[model samples]
Target: MTTQTKVSICLPTCNRPDLIVECIESCLAQTHTNIEILIGDDSKDDRTQRMIATRYQHEPRIRYVRNTPSLGQARNVSSLFNRASGGRILLIHDDDYLAVDGVERLVSLWQRHPDLDVAFANQYEVDQAGHVDREASDRLNADFYRTKSAEGLQQPPGRTGLIQMFPNNGWMANADLVRRISYKEQYGMCCDYVFGVELCLAAKQVYYLNEYVSFYRKTDVSISMTTKRSTSAASVSAYAFIEKLRLDRPLEPARKLALRRIVPIVVSVYSRNHDPIKGLRIAAKNLFAYNYGFSMRLYYHLMMISRSMLTLKPR
Candidate 1:
Protein backbone atom coordinates (compact mmCIF):
# COMPACT_ATOMS: atom_id res chain seq x y z
CA MET A 1 0.00 0.00 0.00
CA THR A 2 1.24 3.50 -0.84
CA THR A 3 1.83 5.65 2.21
CA GLN A 4 -0.41 8.70 2.26
CA THR A 5 1.24 12.06 2.78
CA LYS A 6 0.51 13.45 6.25
CA VAL A 7 -0.16 17.16 6.62
CA SER A 8 0.38 19.08 9.83
CA ILE A 9 -1.77 22.17 10.26
CA CYS A 10 0.07 24.36 12.75
CA LEU A 11 -2.03 27.02 14.48
CA PRO A 12 -0.28 29.49 16.80
CA THR A 13 -3.00 31.17 18.79
CA CYS A 14 -3.36 33.77 21.50
CA ASN A 15 -6.42 34.97 23.45
CA ARG A 16 -8.98 34.34 20.76
CA PRO A 17 -11.25 31.73 22.33
CA ASP A 18 -14.17 33.23 20.45
CA LEU A 19 -12.66 32.56 17.02
CA ILE A 20 -10.32 29.60 17.60
CA VAL A 21 -13.09 27.03 17.76
CA GLU A 22 -14.29 28.01 14.34
CA CYS A 23 -10.77 27.80 12.99
CA ILE A 24 -10.29 24.39 14.58
CA GLU A 25 -13.60 23.12 13.23
CA SER A 26 -12.68 24.22 9.74
CA CYS A 27 -9.45 22.24 9.95
CA LEU A 28 -11.26 19.21 11.32
CA ALA A 29 -13.77 19.28 8.51
CA GLN A 30 -11.08 19.01 5.83
CA THR A 31 -11.72 16.45 3.09
CA HIS A 32 -8.21 15.10 3.54
CA THR A 33 -8.15 12.61 6.40
CA ASN A 34 -4.39 12.20 6.94
CA ILE A 35 -3.88 15.43 8.82
CA GLU A 36 -2.93 16.56 12.28
CA ILE A 37 -4.11 19.84 13.79
CA LEU A 38 -1.32 21.08 16.08
CA ILE A 39 -2.42 24.13 18.04
CA GLY A 40 0.15 25.91 20.22
CA ASP A 41 -1.91 28.12 22.51
CA ASP A 42 -0.13 31.15 23.93
CA SER A 43 -3.28 32.54 25.50
CA LYS A 44 -3.04 34.26 28.86
CA ASP A 45 -6.33 32.68 29.85
CA ASP A 46 -7.40 29.05 29.78
CA ARG A 47 -10.38 29.64 27.56
CA THR A 48 -8.72 28.08 24.52
CA GLN A 49 -7.65 25.04 26.50
CA ARG A 50 -11.13 24.65 27.97
CA MET A 51 -12.77 24.97 24.59
CA ILE A 52 -10.42 22.43 23.00
CA ALA A 53 -10.84 19.92 25.82
CA THR A 54 -14.62 20.19 25.83
CA ARG A 55 -15.22 20.26 22.11
CA TYR A 56 -12.27 18.63 20.28
CA GLN A 57 -10.54 16.41 22.86
CA HIS A 58 -12.22 13.27 21.57
CA GLU A 59 -10.74 13.75 18.13
CA PRO A 60 -7.51 11.80 17.66
CA ARG A 61 -6.06 14.17 15.10
CA ILE A 62 -6.00 17.26 17.35
CA ARG A 63 -2.96 17.95 19.50
CA TYR A 64 -3.18 21.04 21.74
CA VAL A 65 -0.24 22.44 23.68
CA ARG A 66 -0.64 25.47 25.96
CA ASN A 67 2.51 27.38 26.77
CA THR A 68 2.87 27.99 30.52
CA PRO A 69 3.66 31.63 29.86
CA SER A 70 2.99 33.28 26.51
CA LEU A 71 5.80 32.65 23.99
CA GLY A 72 5.09 35.82 21.99
CA GLN A 73 3.82 35.46 18.41
CA ALA A 74 6.95 34.52 16.46
CA ARG A 75 8.29 32.06 19.00
CA ASN A 76 4.92 30.36 19.33
CA VAL A 77 4.76 29.94 15.57
CA SER A 78 8.34 28.69 15.48
CA SER A 79 7.50 26.20 18.20
CA LEU A 80 4.61 24.90 16.12
CA PHE A 81 6.94 24.45 13.14
CA ASN A 82 9.37 22.56 15.34
CA ARG A 83 6.67 20.28 16.75
CA ALA A 84 5.08 19.41 13.43
CA SER A 85 5.78 15.81 12.32
CA GLY A 86 4.10 15.54 8.94
CA GLY A 87 5.46 15.66 5.38
CA ARG A 88 3.60 18.91 4.68
CA ILE A 89 3.01 21.97 6.89
CA LEU A 90 0.19 24.49 6.67
CA LEU A 91 -0.03 27.46 8.98
CA ILE A 92 -3.50 28.72 9.90
CA HIS A 93 -3.69 31.63 12.30
CA ASP A 94 -6.26 31.40 15.11
CA ASP A 95 -8.48 34.01 13.52
CA ASP A 96 -8.22 32.60 10.01
CA TYR A 97 -9.78 29.37 8.70
CA LEU A 98 -9.46 26.94 5.80
CA ALA A 99 -12.15 26.26 3.24
CA VAL A 100 -13.89 22.87 3.54
CA ASP A 101 -11.69 21.11 0.95
CA GLY A 102 -8.67 23.41 1.15
CA VAL A 103 -6.23 20.76 2.32
CA GLU A 104 -7.55 18.17 -0.11
CA ARG A 105 -7.10 20.54 -3.04
CA LEU A 106 -3.59 21.51 -1.90
CA VAL A 107 -2.66 17.85 -1.50
CA SER A 108 -4.09 17.02 -4.91
CA LEU A 109 -1.97 19.74 -6.47
CA TRP A 110 1.09 18.55 -4.57
CA GLN A 111 0.47 15.00 -5.71
CA ARG A 112 0.35 16.18 -9.30
CA HIS A 113 3.48 18.27 -8.90
CA PRO A 114 5.65 16.18 -6.59
CA ASP A 115 8.71 18.39 -7.01
CA LEU A 116 7.02 21.63 -5.90
CA ASP A 117 8.56 23.11 -2.75
CA VAL A 118 5.83 25.62 -1.89
CA ALA A 119 2.20 26.23 -2.89
CA PHE A 120 -0.18 29.09 -2.10
CA ALA A 121 -3.77 29.88 -3.03
CA ASN A 122 -5.79 33.05 -2.96
CA GLN A 123 -7.62 33.93 0.27
CA TYR A 124 -10.74 35.89 1.13
CA GLU A 125 -10.30 39.00 3.25
CA VAL A 126 -13.16 39.15 5.70
CA ASP A 127 -14.28 41.79 8.18
CA GLN A 128 -14.54 41.31 11.95
CA ALA A 129 -18.09 40.05 11.48
CA GLY A 130 -16.79 37.38 9.04
CA HIS A 131 -18.31 39.04 5.98
CA VAL A 132 -16.13 38.79 2.88
CA ASP A 133 -14.93 42.08 1.43
CA ARG A 134 -15.77 41.24 -2.15
CA GLU A 135 -14.02 44.22 -3.70
CA ALA A 136 -10.68 43.49 -2.05
CA SER A 137 -11.10 39.76 -2.69
CA ASP A 138 -11.83 40.36 -6.37
CA ARG A 139 -8.86 42.65 -6.77
CA LEU A 140 -6.51 40.14 -5.11
CA ASN A 141 -7.85 37.27 -7.20
CA ALA A 142 -7.53 39.26 -10.41
CA ASP A 143 -3.97 40.27 -9.69
CA PHE A 144 -2.94 36.73 -8.74
CA TYR A 145 -4.67 35.08 -11.71
CA ARG A 146 -3.35 37.66 -14.14
CA THR A 147 0.19 37.01 -12.96
CA LYS A 148 -0.29 33.22 -13.21
CA SER A 149 -1.86 33.46 -16.67
CA ALA A 150 1.00 35.62 -17.92
CA GLU A 151 3.90 33.82 -16.22
CA GLY A 152 2.65 30.21 -16.47
CA LEU A 153 3.08 27.65 -13.65
CA GLN A 154 6.08 25.72 -15.00
CA GLN A 155 8.51 28.53 -14.17
CA PRO A 156 9.12 29.54 -10.55
CA PRO A 157 8.33 33.17 -9.81
CA GLY A 158 11.61 34.95 -9.24
CA ARG A 159 12.10 37.43 -6.40
CA THR A 160 10.53 40.43 -8.17
CA GLY A 161 7.44 38.60 -9.43
CA LEU A 162 7.01 36.90 -6.04
CA ILE A 163 7.03 40.30 -4.34
CA GLN A 164 4.32 41.63 -6.68
CA MET A 165 2.21 38.47 -6.20
CA PHE A 166 2.38 38.42 -2.42
CA PRO A 167 1.03 35.25 -0.84
CA ASN A 168 -1.36 35.86 2.03
CA ASN A 169 -2.53 33.38 4.71
CA GLY A 170 -3.38 30.50 2.41
CA TRP A 171 0.16 29.15 2.01
CA MET A 172 1.49 25.58 2.33
CA ALA A 173 4.91 24.06 1.94
CA ASN A 174 6.85 20.87 2.32
CA ALA A 175 7.50 20.14 6.01
CA ASP A 176 11.22 19.68 5.56
CA LEU A 177 11.60 22.99 3.78
CA VAL A 178 9.85 24.88 6.59
CA ARG A 179 12.00 23.15 9.22
CA ARG A 180 15.16 24.02 7.30
CA ILE A 181 14.16 27.67 6.77
CA SER A 182 12.82 28.40 10.24
CA TYR A 183 11.15 31.72 11.03
CA LYS A 184 13.49 34.54 12.05
CA GLU A 185 12.41 35.66 15.52
CA GLN A 186 13.92 39.14 15.26
CA TYR A 187 11.42 40.12 12.56
CA GLY A 188 8.48 40.52 14.94
CA MET A 189 5.73 41.96 12.74
CA CYS A 190 7.24 41.25 9.32
CA CYS A 191 8.31 37.66 10.01
CA ASP A 192 5.68 36.18 7.73
CA TYR A 193 6.78 38.31 4.78
CA VAL A 194 10.41 37.49 5.48
CA PHE A 195 9.60 33.80 5.76
CA GLY A 196 7.62 33.77 2.53
CA VAL A 197 10.37 35.59 0.62
CA GLU A 198 12.99 33.16 1.87
CA LEU A 199 10.80 30.21 0.90
CA CYS A 200 10.21 31.55 -2.59
CA LEU A 201 13.91 32.24 -3.08
CA ALA A 202 14.86 28.74 -1.94
CA ALA A 203 12.08 26.79 -3.62
CA LYS A 204 12.85 25.05 -6.93
CA GLN A 205 9.22 25.52 -7.95
CA VAL A 206 6.52 27.58 -6.26
CA TYR A 207 2.93 27.03 -7.38
CA TYR A 208 -0.04 29.39 -7.19
CA LEU A 209 -3.51 27.83 -7.22
CA ASN A 210 -6.59 29.82 -8.22
CA GLU A 211 -8.78 28.42 -5.45
CA TYR A 212 -9.75 30.47 -2.39
CA VAL A 213 -8.22 28.29 0.35
CA SER A 214 -8.70 30.40 3.44
CA PHE A 215 -10.48 33.41 4.96
CA TYR A 216 -8.26 36.03 6.59
CA ARG A 217 -10.06 38.12 9.21
CA LYS A 218 -9.14 41.79 9.02
CA THR A 219 -10.03 43.07 12.45
CA ASP A 220 -8.93 46.37 14.02
CA VAL A 221 -7.19 44.37 16.75
CA SER A 222 -5.05 42.34 14.33
CA ILE A 223 -1.26 42.54 14.76
CA SER A 224 -0.70 44.34 11.47
CA MET A 225 -3.46 46.85 12.20
CA THR A 226 -2.31 47.43 15.78
CA THR A 227 1.34 47.76 14.71
CA LYS A 228 0.40 50.28 12.02
CA ARG A 229 -1.48 52.32 14.64
CA SER A 230 1.37 52.39 17.18
CA THR A 231 4.82 52.04 15.61
CA SER A 232 6.96 51.49 12.48
CA ALA A 233 8.20 48.04 13.53
CA ALA A 234 6.87 46.39 10.39
CA SER A 235 8.66 48.90 8.17
CA VAL A 236 11.82 48.60 10.21
CA SER A 237 11.69 44.82 9.78
CA ALA A 238 11.12 45.18 6.05
CA TYR A 239 14.09 47.53 5.73
CA ALA A 240 16.27 45.13 7.65
CA PHE A 241 15.26 42.19 5.44
CA ILE A 242 15.72 44.18 2.25
CA GLU A 243 19.18 45.23 3.32
CA LYS A 244 20.00 41.63 4.20
CA LEU A 245 18.91 40.46 0.76
CA ARG A 246 20.90 43.18 -0.97
CA LEU A 247 24.04 42.42 1.04
CA ASP A 248 23.78 38.63 1.07
CA ARG A 249 22.00 37.49 -2.09
CA PRO A 250 23.04 37.97 -5.73
CA LEU A 251 19.97 39.58 -7.31
CA GLU A 252 19.20 40.05 -10.98
CA PRO A 253 18.93 43.64 -12.26
CA ALA A 254 15.13 43.57 -12.14
CA ARG A 255 15.07 42.39 -8.52
CA LYS A 256 17.71 44.96 -7.63
CA LEU A 257 15.57 47.73 -9.17
CA ALA A 258 12.51 46.46 -7.27
CA LEU A 259 14.41 46.69 -3.99
CA ARG A 260 15.48 50.25 -4.81
CA ARG A 261 11.84 51.19 -5.34
CA ILE A 262 10.67 49.42 -2.17
CA VAL A 263 13.25 51.02 0.17
CA PRO A 264 11.71 54.51 -0.04
CA ILE A 265 8.20 53.23 0.66
CA VAL A 266 9.41 51.49 3.84
CA VAL A 267 11.26 54.66 4.83
CA SER A 268 8.04 56.61 4.27
CA VAL A 269 6.27 54.34 6.73
CA TYR A 270 8.85 55.24 9.36
CA SER A 271 8.51 58.93 8.50
CA ARG A 272 4.71 58.75 8.80
CA ASN A 273 5.05 57.24 12.28
CA HIS A 274 6.97 60.41 13.41
CA ASP A 275 10.22 58.48 13.29
CA PRO A 276 12.21 60.75 10.98
CA ILE A 277 15.49 60.02 12.73
CA LYS A 278 15.30 56.28 12.11
CA GLY A 279 13.98 56.87 8.62
CA LEU A 280 16.86 59.26 7.85
CA ARG A 281 19.33 56.78 9.28
CA ILE A 282 17.91 54.01 7.07
CA ALA A 283 17.95 56.28 4.03
CA ALA A 284 21.51 57.37 4.72
CA LYS A 285 22.72 53.80 5.27
CA ASN A 286 21.08 52.54 2.10
CA LEU A 287 22.21 55.60 0.20
CA PHE A 288 25.87 55.29 1.02
CA ALA A 289 26.44 51.54 1.39
CA TYR A 290 23.64 49.83 -0.56
CA ASN A 291 24.06 51.85 -3.82
CA TYR A 292 20.57 53.38 -3.73
CA GLY A 293 20.56 56.06 -6.44
CA PHE A 294 20.43 59.86 -6.01
CA SER A 295 16.69 60.06 -6.65
CA MET A 296 15.80 57.77 -3.76
CA ARG A 297 18.25 59.56 -1.46
CA LEU A 298 16.78 62.93 -2.36
CA TYR A 299 13.22 61.65 -1.95
CA TYR A 300 13.84 60.22 1.52
CA HIS A 301 15.66 63.35 2.65
CA LEU A 302 12.87 65.63 1.37
CA MET A 303 10.11 63.47 2.81
CA MET A 304 11.74 63.28 6.23
CA ILE A 305 12.31 67.04 6.28
CA SER A 306 8.72 67.70 5.20
CA ARG A 307 7.37 65.38 7.91
CA SER A 308 9.60 67.00 10.52
CA MET A 309 8.46 70.47 9.48
CA LEU A 310 4.81 69.45 9.52
CA THR A 311 5.16 68.17 13.09
CA LEU A 312 6.94 71.35 14.33
CA LYS A 313 5.22 73.63 16.83
CA PRO A 314 3.52 76.89 15.72
CA ARG A 315 5.73 78.97 18.08
Candidate 2:
Protein backbone atom coordinates (compact mmCIF):
# COMPACT_ATOMS: atom_id res chain seq x y z
CA MET A 1 0.00 0.00 0.00
CA THR A 2 1.08 3.56 -0.67
CA THR A 3 1.93 6.07 2.07
CA GLN A 4 -1.21 7.96 1.07
CA THR A 5 -3.53 4.95 1.15
CA LYS A 6 -7.18 6.00 1.35
CA VAL A 7 -9.41 4.86 4.26
CA SER A 8 -13.20 4.85 4.45
CA ILE A 9 -14.72 5.39 7.87
CA CYS A 10 -18.06 3.58 7.80
CA LEU A 11 -20.33 5.08 10.45
CA PRO A 12 -23.76 3.45 10.63
CA THR A 13 -26.51 5.21 12.57
CA CYS A 14 -30.15 4.93 13.39
CA ASN A 15 -32.34 7.70 15.00
CA ARG A 16 -29.61 8.70 17.43
CA PRO A 17 -28.87 12.05 15.83
CA ASP A 18 -27.53 13.38 19.10
CA LEU A 19 -24.92 10.63 19.44
CA ILE A 20 -23.82 10.44 15.80
CA VAL A 21 -22.63 14.02 15.62
CA GLU A 22 -19.58 13.37 17.73
CA CYS A 23 -18.82 10.27 15.66
CA ILE A 24 -18.81 12.27 12.44
CA GLU A 25 -16.66 14.95 13.99
CA SER A 26 -14.18 12.33 15.21
CA CYS A 27 -13.87 10.95 11.67
CA LEU A 28 -13.34 14.44 10.36
CA ALA A 29 -10.64 14.94 12.94
CA GLN A 30 -8.59 11.97 11.73
CA THR A 31 -4.98 12.88 11.02
CA HIS A 32 -5.02 10.77 7.86
CA THR A 33 -6.02 13.12 5.06
CA ASN A 34 -6.85 10.47 2.42
CA ILE A 35 -10.19 9.34 3.75
CA GLU A 36 -13.96 9.55 3.37
CA ILE A 37 -16.70 9.18 5.97
CA LEU A 38 -19.75 7.18 4.87
CA ILE A 39 -22.81 7.47 7.08
CA GLY A 40 -25.72 5.09 6.51
CA ASP A 41 -28.58 6.53 8.50
CA ASP A 42 -31.11 3.81 9.27
CA SER A 43 -33.32 6.14 11.24
CA LYS A 44 -37.04 5.84 10.58
CA ASP A 45 -37.31 9.63 10.50
CA ASP A 46 -35.13 12.19 8.70
CA ARG A 47 -33.68 13.49 11.97
CA THR A 48 -30.21 12.09 11.34
CA GLN A 49 -30.13 13.27 7.72
CA ARG A 50 -31.24 16.71 8.83
CA MET A 51 -28.56 16.85 11.46
CA ILE A 52 -25.84 15.97 8.95
CA ALA A 53 -27.22 18.44 6.40
CA THR A 54 -27.16 21.30 8.87
CA ARG A 55 -23.94 20.48 10.72
CA TYR A 56 -21.71 18.93 8.06
CA GLN A 57 -23.31 20.12 4.83
CA HIS A 58 -20.21 21.89 3.56
CA GLU A 59 -17.89 19.02 4.44
CA PRO A 60 -16.82 17.34 1.21
CA ARG A 61 -15.18 14.37 2.92
CA ILE A 62 -18.53 12.99 4.11
CA ARG A 63 -20.93 10.96 1.96
CA TYR A 64 -24.22 10.40 3.74
CA VAL A 65 -26.88 7.84 2.75
CA ARG A 66 -30.33 7.88 4.30
CA ASN A 67 -31.49 4.26 4.03
CA THR A 68 -35.12 4.04 3.00
CA PRO A 69 -37.49 2.25 5.39
CA SER A 70 -34.48 1.61 7.62
CA LEU A 71 -32.10 -1.25 6.76
CA GLY A 72 -31.89 -2.58 10.30
CA GLN A 73 -28.73 -3.06 12.42
CA ALA A 74 -27.13 -5.85 10.41
CA ARG A 75 -27.92 -4.62 6.90
CA ASN A 76 -27.13 -0.99 7.74
CA VAL A 77 -23.60 -2.13 8.62
CA SER A 78 -23.27 -4.15 5.42
CA SER A 79 -24.59 -1.22 3.33
CA LEU A 80 -21.76 1.00 4.52
CA PHE A 81 -19.20 -1.60 3.48
CA ASN A 82 -20.86 -1.87 0.08
CA ARG A 83 -20.30 1.85 -0.56
CA ALA A 84 -16.78 2.21 0.87
CA SER A 85 -14.27 3.62 -1.67
CA GLY A 86 -11.06 3.39 0.32
CA GLY A 87 -8.43 0.67 0.15
CA ARG A 88 -9.18 0.07 3.83
CA ILE A 89 -12.37 0.58 5.89
CA LEU A 90 -12.62 1.53 9.54
CA LEU A 91 -16.00 1.08 11.17
CA ILE A 92 -17.03 3.51 13.90
CA HIS A 93 -20.42 2.94 15.51
CA ASP A 94 -22.66 6.02 15.66
CA ASP A 95 -22.60 5.85 19.44
CA ASP A 96 -18.76 5.75 19.52
CA TYR A 97 -16.12 8.32 18.58
CA LEU A 98 -12.53 7.80 17.53
CA ALA A 99 -9.46 9.09 19.32
CA VAL A 100 -8.02 11.93 17.16
CA ASP A 101 -5.17 9.84 15.75
CA GLY A 102 -7.03 6.49 15.68
CA VAL A 103 -6.94 6.26 11.92
CA GLU A 104 -3.36 7.56 11.69
CA ARG A 105 -2.03 5.01 14.17
CA LEU A 106 -3.95 2.01 12.79
CA VAL A 107 -3.07 3.03 9.26
CA SER A 108 0.57 3.26 10.21
CA LEU A 109 0.40 -0.24 11.71
CA TRP A 110 -1.16 -1.63 8.53
CA GLN A 111 1.42 0.13 6.39
CA ARG A 112 4.16 -1.45 8.44
CA HIS A 113 2.59 -4.88 7.91
CA PRO A 114 1.39 -4.48 4.34
CA ASP A 115 -0.22 -7.91 4.24
CA LEU A 116 -2.45 -7.22 7.26
CA ASP A 117 -6.01 -8.31 6.59
CA VAL A 118 -7.56 -6.84 9.74
CA ALA A 119 -6.28 -4.63 12.58
CA PHE A 120 -8.04 -3.42 15.74
CA ALA A 121 -7.16 -1.92 19.12
CA ASN A 122 -8.44 -1.14 22.57
CA GLN A 123 -11.04 1.49 23.62
CA TYR A 124 -12.01 3.46 26.68
CA GLU A 125 -15.60 3.03 27.85
CA VAL A 126 -17.49 6.20 28.69
CA ASP A 127 -20.97 6.81 30.01
CA GLN A 128 -23.65 8.99 28.38
CA ALA A 129 -22.04 12.18 29.70
CA GLY A 130 -18.65 11.04 28.37
CA HIS A 131 -17.14 10.40 31.79
CA VAL A 132 -14.63 7.58 31.53
CA ASP A 133 -15.25 4.57 33.76
CA ARG A 134 -11.68 3.66 34.58
CA GLU A 135 -12.51 0.40 36.36
CA ALA A 136 -14.98 -0.95 33.82
CA SER A 137 -12.56 -0.21 30.99
CA ASP A 138 -9.81 -2.19 32.66
CA ARG A 139 -12.07 -5.18 33.28
CA LEU A 140 -13.36 -5.07 29.72
CA ASN A 141 -9.83 -5.00 28.33
CA ALA A 142 -8.76 -7.90 30.52
CA ASP A 143 -11.93 -9.83 29.70
CA PHE A 144 -11.21 -9.37 25.98
CA TYR A 145 -7.48 -10.21 26.24
CA ARG A 146 -6.43 -6.61 25.54
CA THR A 147 -3.42 -6.89 27.82
CA LYS A 148 -1.11 -3.90 28.15
CA SER A 149 1.87 -6.18 27.57
CA ALA A 150 1.32 -7.18 23.95
CA GLU A 151 0.70 -5.47 20.59
CA GLY A 152 1.22 -6.33 16.90
CA LEU A 153 0.46 -9.22 14.51
CA GLN A 154 -1.41 -12.26 15.86
CA GLN A 155 0.05 -15.59 14.80
CA PRO A 156 -3.27 -17.44 14.59
CA PRO A 157 -5.84 -14.69 14.12
CA GLY A 158 -8.95 -16.85 14.63
CA ARG A 159 -7.90 -18.03 18.06
CA THR A 160 -7.07 -14.49 19.21
CA GLY A 161 -10.37 -13.16 17.81
CA LEU A 162 -12.46 -15.94 19.36
CA ILE A 163 -10.97 -15.18 22.75
CA GLN A 164 -10.57 -11.39 22.44
CA MET A 165 -13.30 -10.26 19.97
CA PHE A 166 -10.93 -8.21 17.81
CA PRO A 167 -13.71 -6.86 15.55
CA ASN A 168 -14.44 -4.24 18.17
CA ASN A 169 -14.18 -0.45 17.88
CA GLY A 170 -10.94 1.04 16.51
CA TRP A 171 -10.72 -1.69 13.83
CA MET A 172 -9.39 -1.20 10.31
CA ALA A 173 -9.42 -3.87 7.61
CA ASN A 174 -8.63 -4.35 3.97
CA ALA A 175 -11.54 -3.14 1.86
CA ASP A 176 -11.39 -6.29 -0.22
CA LEU A 177 -11.69 -8.62 2.78
CA VAL A 178 -14.60 -6.66 4.24
CA ARG A 179 -16.25 -6.27 0.84
CA ARG A 180 -16.13 -10.02 0.39
CA ILE A 181 -17.78 -10.38 3.80
CA SER A 182 -21.29 -9.29 4.78
CA TYR A 183 -23.07 -8.95 8.09
CA LYS A 184 -25.49 -11.83 7.60
CA GLU A 185 -29.04 -11.01 8.61
CA GLN A 186 -29.23 -14.37 10.30
CA TYR A 187 -26.61 -13.32 12.86
CA GLY A 188 -28.93 -10.59 14.21
CA MET A 189 -27.51 -8.77 17.29
CA CYS A 190 -24.29 -10.78 17.12
CA CYS A 191 -23.65 -10.12 13.45
CA ASP A 192 -20.53 -8.10 14.11
CA TYR A 193 -18.80 -10.91 16.01
CA VAL A 194 -19.77 -13.45 13.39
CA PHE A 195 -18.48 -11.14 10.66
CA GLY A 196 -15.21 -10.63 12.50
CA VAL A 197 -14.63 -14.37 12.85
CA GLU A 198 -15.20 -14.88 9.16
CA LEU A 199 -12.64 -12.20 8.32
CA CYS A 200 -10.12 -13.68 10.73
CA LEU A 201 -10.39 -17.15 9.25
CA ALA A 202 -10.30 -16.03 5.64
CA ALA A 203 -7.57 -13.41 5.88
CA LYS A 204 -5.00 -15.47 7.80
CA GLN A 205 -3.32 -12.16 8.62
CA VAL A 206 -4.64 -10.06 11.51
CA TYR A 207 -3.11 -7.57 13.94
CA TYR A 208 -3.94 -6.42 17.44
CA LEU A 209 -2.52 -3.02 18.42
CA ASN A 210 -2.97 -2.83 22.18
CA GLU A 211 -3.61 0.88 22.50
CA TYR A 212 -6.75 2.86 23.14
CA VAL A 213 -7.86 4.24 19.79
CA SER A 214 -11.51 5.16 20.48
CA PHE A 215 -14.19 5.82 23.08
CA TYR A 216 -17.04 3.32 23.42
CA ARG A 217 -20.09 5.26 24.59
CA LYS A 218 -22.12 3.36 27.12
CA THR A 219 -25.67 4.50 26.36
CA ASP A 220 -28.83 2.95 27.78
CA VAL A 221 -30.00 1.71 24.39
CA SER A 222 -26.64 0.37 23.28
CA ILE A 223 -26.76 -3.47 23.14
CA SER A 224 -23.92 -3.66 25.64
CA MET A 225 -26.44 -2.46 28.21
CA THR A 226 -28.59 -5.30 29.54
CA THR A 227 -32.22 -5.16 28.47
CA LYS A 228 -35.42 -5.87 30.38
CA ARG A 229 -35.79 -9.15 28.48
CA SER A 230 -33.51 -11.75 27.03
CA THR A 231 -33.44 -12.78 23.37
CA SER A 232 -32.24 -16.32 24.04
CA ALA A 233 -32.98 -17.64 20.56
CA ALA A 234 -30.85 -14.97 18.89
CA SER A 235 -27.98 -15.63 21.25
CA VAL A 236 -28.36 -19.38 20.78
CA SER A 237 -28.36 -19.06 17.00
CA ALA A 238 -25.15 -17.03 16.93
CA TYR A 239 -23.47 -19.51 19.24
CA ALA A 240 -24.65 -22.31 16.99
CA PHE A 241 -22.92 -20.61 14.08
CA ILE A 242 -19.74 -20.48 16.08
CA GLU A 243 -20.02 -24.10 17.12
CA LYS A 244 -20.48 -25.30 13.56
CA LEU A 245 -17.45 -23.43 12.20
CA ARG A 246 -14.43 -25.59 11.28
CA LEU A 247 -11.19 -24.01 12.39
CA ASP A 248 -7.69 -25.36 12.69
CA ARG A 249 -7.91 -28.74 14.44
CA PRO A 250 -6.38 -27.45 17.67
CA LEU A 251 -8.72 -24.45 17.96
CA GLU A 252 -12.04 -26.29 17.79
CA PRO A 253 -12.20 -27.43 21.41
CA ALA A 254 -11.07 -24.05 22.67
CA ARG A 255 -13.72 -22.41 20.48
CA LYS A 256 -16.53 -24.62 21.79
CA LEU A 257 -15.47 -24.13 25.40
CA ALA A 258 -14.90 -20.39 24.91
CA LEU A 259 -18.52 -19.27 25.40
CA ARG A 260 -19.14 -22.04 27.91
CA ARG A 261 -16.25 -21.03 30.15
CA ILE A 262 -16.97 -17.30 29.97
CA VAL A 263 -20.72 -16.81 29.76
CA PRO A 264 -22.02 -18.96 32.65
CA ILE A 265 -24.17 -16.01 33.70
CA VAL A 266 -26.48 -16.80 30.80
CA VAL A 267 -27.43 -20.26 32.12
CA SER A 268 -30.56 -18.99 33.84
CA VAL A 269 -31.46 -16.76 30.91
CA TYR A 270 -31.22 -19.72 28.55
CA SER A 271 -33.25 -21.85 30.92
CA ARG A 272 -36.01 -19.25 31.16
CA ASN A 273 -36.33 -19.03 27.38
CA HIS A 274 -37.01 -22.73 26.83
CA ASP A 275 -39.83 -25.11 27.74
CA PRO A 276 -39.12 -27.42 30.66
CA ILE A 277 -38.24 -30.31 28.36
CA LYS A 278 -35.84 -28.22 26.29
CA GLY A 279 -34.45 -26.54 29.38
CA LEU A 280 -33.67 -29.84 31.06
CA ARG A 281 -32.18 -31.15 27.83
CA ILE A 282 -29.91 -28.09 27.60
CA ALA A 283 -28.92 -28.52 31.23
CA ALA A 284 -28.05 -32.15 30.64
CA LYS A 285 -26.15 -31.38 27.45
CA ASN A 286 -23.87 -28.86 29.14
CA LEU A 287 -23.86 -30.11 32.70
CA PHE A 288 -20.07 -30.11 32.74
CA ALA A 289 -19.89 -26.73 31.01
CA TYR A 290 -22.00 -25.17 33.74
CA ASN A 291 -19.75 -26.81 36.36
CA TYR A 292 -22.78 -26.72 38.64
CA GLY A 293 -23.33 -29.70 40.95
CA PHE A 294 -26.65 -31.50 41.44
CA SER A 295 -27.94 -28.69 43.65
CA MET A 296 -27.29 -26.12 40.95
CA ARG A 297 -29.13 -28.24 38.35
CA LEU A 298 -32.15 -28.44 40.69
CA TYR A 299 -31.95 -24.69 41.23
CA TYR A 300 -31.86 -24.07 37.48
CA HIS A 301 -35.07 -26.07 36.98
CA LEU A 302 -36.85 -24.19 39.79
CA MET A 303 -35.89 -20.80 38.37
CA MET A 304 -36.89 -21.87 34.88
CA ILE A 305 -40.29 -22.99 36.14
CA SER A 306 -40.90 -19.75 37.99
CA ARG A 307 -39.91 -17.53 35.05
CA SER A 308 -41.79 -19.69 32.57
CA MET A 309 -44.94 -19.46 34.69
CA LEU A 310 -44.53 -15.71 34.99
CA THR A 311 -44.23 -15.23 31.24
CA LEU A 312 -47.24 -17.47 30.49
CA LYS A 313 -49.56 -15.31 32.60
CA PRO A 314 -51.29 -12.41 30.80
CA ARG A 315 -50.44 -8.83 31.81
Q: How large is the C-alpha RMSD of every model relative to the true structure?
A: 4.2, 3.1
The digit string of per-residue lDDT tens for model 1 on 86-107 reads 9989999999999998988777
lDDT of 2 by residue, 83-116 (tens): 9999999999998999999898888886688778
Q: Please give the CA lDDT of all the candidate structures.
A: 0.75, 0.76
Clashes counted in candidate 2 amount to 0
CA deviation > 4 Å runs, candidate 2: 1-3, 223-228, 232-234, 261-266, 292-315
Clashes of each: 0, 0
**lDDT of model 2 at position 133:** 92
Scored against the true structure, residue 290 in model 2 reaches a CA lDDT of 61
Q: Relative to the unseen true structure, what is the C-alpha lDDT of residue 184 in candidate 2, on a scale of 0 to 100?
A: 85
Name the candidate that leads on TM-score.
2
lDDT of 2: 0.76
* lDDT of model 2, residue 9: 93
